[model samples]
Target: MVDVYWRIGMHGDQSTLRRRAETRGDWAPLAPGHLAPGWGDGHGDGRPYLEHMADVARAAEISGFVGGLMPSFPFTDDPFAAAASLVEETRTFRFMVAFQPGFVHPWGAARLSAALQQLSGGRLVYNVITGGGGPAQRWWGDEVEHDRRYARTAEFLDLLRRSWAPRPQSADGEFYRLADAYLPTDLADQPFPEIYFSGSSPAAIAAAGPFADYYLSWLEPHTALTEKFTAVRAASQALGRTPRFAVRIDIVSRDTEAEAWEVVRDGFSGVDLTALAEGRDGDSVGVARARSFIDGPVRDVRDLEVEPHVWGGFSLLRGGPSFGLVGSHEQVAERLNGLVDAGVDAFILAGVPHLEEAFRVGDFVLPRLTHHSPQGALS
Candidate 1:
């Protein structure tokens, strides 16, 4: 059974993929003399973004989506705070919070996670992101080097797991030291949140082996994914552990192929071809690999299609993952099923104006998927 999850975008989002008149975060009239909605002027800052997030979560839950991946980015709201705000959002919709382990100490993180897991009844999943070395890390005043970050993360997880022990646990590591450390009985008894680890470097794969419940990566070429997943599996096996695989991808689905293509075609015009495709220095092999799929983009957006149903035009309109599934509902579902067959057990999917798209995908794309149910649910 494959897990189908929607992306709960914490930052501002555009209504559509088009960038010419992009009204990120909120909505407004883009054209001269265009009539505005009656409710438009009434909302000064529009509604609180959390209200919008709840609407999306509710839609995703009712639509049969397993949950939503709450991403952590510099410009986004805190995933922990955002998830807490939606405690009453949906009954079973999980919050897969994407966060850099460096930002919080393992013990503190465990306590916060335990509180939410208790409140949400085990509806918490951790998307553990080691900071990609660049200005972003500097923005947070982080001084750790690229490879050492993963080492610290490995240590962090080691201590984090130890923190949940029924008896006090102690640890002395390069990055952390704990003496007779343990959670309170109530918090310690809370279910552990599954860790979905992401990274593409050698250090990353090594660090993920022992802790990752799901070895996660953004969507890459299928062959590339096969090789990477194989390495992660080997790493896990060496330690007598097994971990499932997941991919995060964007989606563009419509009733017909032409309709879907039309969206990208319109979005292609808004792309700044020069900046969107250029490769820059980064410590993350994953970020570099994601950008690598679009080999020598010249004119059209479809040129970035590394494979069928896979289009690398996402950065043209918004930030985040560049490659995504772009086709009719059947076509997108077919491609998703293909990934499942290739060993992917979960997918973190996103689209613009997350509120409406959650319903669109839940109604159209999700039903067509073959592995949408979990293994326990199967006869």
Candidate 2:
């Protein structure tokens, strides 16, 4: 069996999600901003903030999609606040909120997640980030060396796990301190919200053992994915943990393969070439990884289609997860199957002009995916 997920709305133009929904079919839209470039103004104030996220969440439910990803960052709307507002507006649609160790206290974070879980009736998913962008780090006043952030995150998650346990948790780590902290709420029946993390650093891989329900990855070819997954599994095993796999991807779907490619080509027009270059130039692991793809043996970032039905053009603008699955319904299904064969269990997929892309993917791709095989969501 295989599990395939899609996220259509990501912070972008105001009407991107709605327009996509109207033209295509019902699909999920991840809230825009936080990590999206060109979103925050020169003053570092984010536009299309909570209002845009609420609209996208409302539209996703009304229009018929799964859920949205709520990103956490000082510059954008708070993930918890954004998700809390959408609880009543959406029915089955859930919210995936991003978090990092350095930003909030572990006890406070656990309490926040518990409240959200209860309010949304257990419709909360947490994405753990290790602080990537250099500018974003400056906002939090966290200037730890690259790998150290992951080390601190591991400590953070350890405290978080203990906080959620039946007995109060006590921890005294270099980065965090907790003394018999325990949540008053009882969630005996409903499970705690799932945790997600993505990183290629050795420390990040090593940290997955402590707390990770879903291990996330950027868009990579099948061969690269195979190698990465093998290493991640080994790391998790050494730590006595079993983590599921997921990949973040943009998508281009159409009635036929040719039509899908046409949509992919059209998306290039929306790229902010100047901002893209600036973001790429910033000192961050994401930018360096993107440059390696473009400047190395893969001379052109555009040549990053390591497998059929996968494209890396979006990586040209952003970092971390910068690839898209491009093809017709069936072709998309096959590519997804290839990833499943490589041990990928979950997918956080999206597309440009989000609204229409959501419908195309949800209506066309999801059904094919379900028919091909069906599996449970991230446990």
Candidate 3:
């Protein structure tokens, strides 16, 4: 049976939005500014983001989510700093931090990972993000070519392993070099934290082959997913490793299928098609791949629905992980079970009104899944 892991994608809510939503005692809000300018609550206000992450981590624990995924960007709070703060405030919930190769050296990242693991009592997980947007890369003083990013990523992970290895260690890779240096001798019995990466590009999969513990991706149709996994598995096999699979989805669960679709309908009622088109056309390789799939072979995203309960609306609007298995609790479970039929082992799902939707899914649907398969059903 596959273990069902749940995490919330708490991408920032604007400041005004945060103020309104914070009325709930259980709600804690995070804003922009902790990382870079031009993001978060105030439009370009230089407010720090640590407050938001700390608040969200507290709320996630209250909401029954196992952890919070801190998105990495020049425009967001530094994930390592944010995680350190949150770990002190919470006891159980985990902190998953995203990092890109170009932004931080592997040794520096490994050091941060070890410190957080010790400070948090093993509640830290690393989200290994290969560089994505061309513009974003330029902002970092790096004009990395698309495919080369993944190659660097592979080298980065190799360096990390060497840096954090058990004893005296050294490694030389195409992108990095280390001398006869070993990690601090005090750190023992330190398990390598879970590594998660997302991309549809072939180079991305090949790069992730040896190191990633969990291959995360944007939700795709069942048929398309089967093919994607086939390639991923083959790549891992070529490296003589076995990696688990996970997905990020935006779910809308209601009492009935019709009600669920209505929630989706109302959510998108204000979405400007023109703006969405403009954003989609914006140059992000991840978005480009997603857009290509939607417009290319998979012309209409609706056609990619593997079951009645599953819908690819989010994928259409956003890039990477966009598809949500929307419907009644039972219907949603059935669709999720289908992924188990293929080889998916974990799901990281979220919704628009995150806190409330999490309650609905956790209280209602999670129990059914637990009852049906106490040890995790998707075997």
Candidate 4:
């Protein structure tokens, strides 16, 4: 069965206008001649950072999600630190902490992953991310070309695996070199965290086949996803390995299809076009593919229906993983199940306000889908 996971927000609150206004602060008034609604102007509930994170973590855990994905970004709190802090907040749900390859040395990453696995009682997973694009790469002082980034990532993963081996191991790769590196803390037979990797480029697929335990893709049409899965499967087969497949996407499910569309319209009503354009101007293959959906014939909010239930309205506001499934609960479930039929083994999903939507999906959609329990072995 496909295992389902939720995306945990490490930044500001993700509530809608009504919820934010009720719990946070009053909304700003719309000015004359403005086409968008006045939102995101409220003073939030003033919860401490840790307190908010704990609430989200507990909600997702109790809601039957297998895990939560904590992303690594220049702006958000450090994923490792946040995951470590959140370990005590939840019991069963795993934390897929995003770790960039070149940002830290492979030895350090292996050590950190081991420590986190111990600390969380084997509830840690690693989402290995190669730098996103030119701007984000520059921010991290990584000037390597696109393909070289994946090459470095391949070397990094190779070293990380060796570093976690029971005995001391060493590696001399193009981007990393280590001599007799070993973790001091005993893992006590605990396996290393599962490696979840994401990239759409050829270099990424080439690297992923050798190392990735789960290959992740942003939401795309069934045809596109089938092609990608075939490519990755073929690449991994060449190496005598078969990596599992996973997908990450947003969801806006409601009681009825019309209600879901209403929610989308309201959510994007206040979107800033300039900010959206800036986000779309990324060089990554994933970014380019997502932008293509919006750049096609469906160029306006009213035309975001890319498929029966899949919506590209979010692509106008966000960059990576911008597509979303929007419809009634049953409709959304059908779309997700279709992906599962097409070979997606896992789903990493999120909505605008994670806390509430975790419950919504857990109570409504999850029970309707054929999914594994949190502790069940993934297929």
Candidate 5:
């Protein structure tokens, strides 16, 4: 049985509306030598920060989602701070907090993870992000090359695992060096939070193969996903470890297939071709893969039908987790079942206007899926 998770938007923007605004040229274009336009100034359609986070957290918890993934980005609210605040608002729901290794020392990461695990009663899961491109990396003053960043992340994870040991730990690496580094209190009694790693580059797979408890990827076709699974499995097998596999995707489910397609059409109506073309100028492998779908046979929004209920129109505008599943409740379930059959052990799903979509999928789609019980909340 594959576990399902939802994304909590930490950027403080109504995703659909924000995209719509961009399409209508409501925001300014990039200035000379600028990489991207400024976003999330709280000017577009979005709930107040506190209200939005609280509403989404409660909705995800009550909807039987296993957890909610809080993304980390230079343009958005700090995920660590957001998760800490959300902990006091919800009960029994886990948080997958995304973080980049280079932004914080290994000791600091370990301590924060331990503290969150204790505070949440073992409900913290760390999503290690090595970042995507040079532009975003430069924002954090990280000048390391792509492959070296993965190497640093591997060392970071190694030290973090050791820091959670019953006793003090020490490590000396090319990127980081620590002596007698340990948490203030022993975290051995409490289980360490699971580590979820995501990357599509070779260095990324090599780094995560021996460490990550789960390997996550943005949504790709089944054949592409199968190849990725094979590569990761081989890497893990070489290290005598078998890590779980997961994917992040968007969903648009309604009572009928036509209704679901209608939602997609409306969302696609806001597409900004100019912005989409500019966003593809990045060097991120994930971004390139996503843009590939848009540049391929998917000429128009209606041509985004990739596989069965899978839709690629989201890829035309969004960078990460661009693929969306659009269909009736049963059809969505069927699409998910196919991915699960293709070796996906978990799913991180989201939709526009997150709160409403959370309940819609929770009420209509989850109950129809096999290997899932909607009777109780996630433990």
Candidate 6:
């Protein structure tokens, strides 16, 4: 069975792709006064930040998505706090909380996740991120190099699993020292959160080999994506483990192909692709691979079409996951099934206005899937 997750916009969202100057949920008022963009007219929806996020989670829960991915960043609300807040609003809707291992100690993370699992009845997953070494690391005051950061993550995950055991666990590793560490019986009994690890580097895969339940990647070309997954699976299997593969991709699905293209007909005409690529500030191999997709200039929007229906203009518009599907529902679904055939068992999908797109994809695209069932949380 394949699982599909919607991305929660913790960093705020705009109403349209065309008009993005004003974001609704960044640092300031999350919902801004009372009116959300589509909430309409003279009256206001009157939702605060957490309330708006609950609505987003509820939308995904009802729209056949298995869960919502709450991404963490310096500028955004804590994914753990955001995910914990929604347990009352949603049932059976898993929360994929993204976090770097260094931020919270493995034992503390275990306690938090176990409490969440107990509350939400095992509706939790993890998107373990090792920081992309750059200024972001500097801001975090982490002087660890690229390879060592991943090594720390591997140690962190190993300890995390051990911390879940009822018996006392001890480890004296390079980055951390634990003496007789163990969770309470009830907390330890709560199912350990399944991990979906992200990294485009060899060290990342090596870390994922022993502990990850899913090896995750941002969407790339089908061929490259297949090759990457092949390597990941081989490494995991060699470690005597079996990890699944997942990809994150944004979408622009519409009733017809023409309507989808019309959403960004002149997207690249005025924008400088080189300047956009150069302006990116992360040191991630995945980022580099995604940026490399747009090698030449841009006279038309079609110039960024790296593959059939896969558009690269998303990097010009957003921060993460540069390539995404931009076609009619049928075309997008076809491409999705193609990716599945190439060995993807899961997906983290997103759109411009998250709440609205949750319903749109559920209504038009999900039914076309080869392995889909309407997976709403029980009311």
Top-lDDT candidate index: 1
The lDDT of each candidate is 0.82, 0.64, 0.64, 0.76, 0.75, 0.81
Tens digits of per-residue lDDT, candidate 6, 14-106, equal: 566654443555343433342343243544355556766888889989999999899987778888999988897897789999999987788
Residue range 91-125, candidate 5, lDDT tens digits: 98889999999988888887877878888898888
TM-score of 1: 0.92
Cα lDDT of model 1 by residue, 190-254, tens digit: 99998999999999999999999999998888888889999999999999998899999999999
Q: Which RMSD does model 6 reach against the true structure?
A: 4.8
Against the true structure, what is each candidate's TM-score?
Answer: 0.92, 0.79, 0.80, 0.87, 0.87, 0.92
**For residues 34-140, could you state the per-residue lDDT of candidate 3 as single tens digits?**
23223445544543444544555665576566776666765554677777867889998777787888777777777778877777788888788876665667887
TM-score for candidate 3, residues paired by index: 0.80
lDDT for model 2, please: 0.64
Can you tell me which runs of candidate 6 are displaced by over 4 Å?
A: 26-47, 266-275, 371-379
**CA displacement after TM-score superposition, residue 264 of candidate 6 (Å):** 2.2
Native-referenced Cα lDDT, model 4: 0.76
* Tens-digit lDDT string for candidate 2 (297-364): 44333455555666766644332255677778877766776566557777777665554456656667
The CA lDDT at 153 in model 3 is 90
Give the better candidate number (1 or 4) by lDDT. Answer: 1
Worst 10 residues of 2 by lDDT: 17-26
Show model 1 residue runs off by greater than 4 Å: 20-46, 278-281, 371-379
Poorest lDDT segment (10 consecutive residues) of candidate 3: 17-26
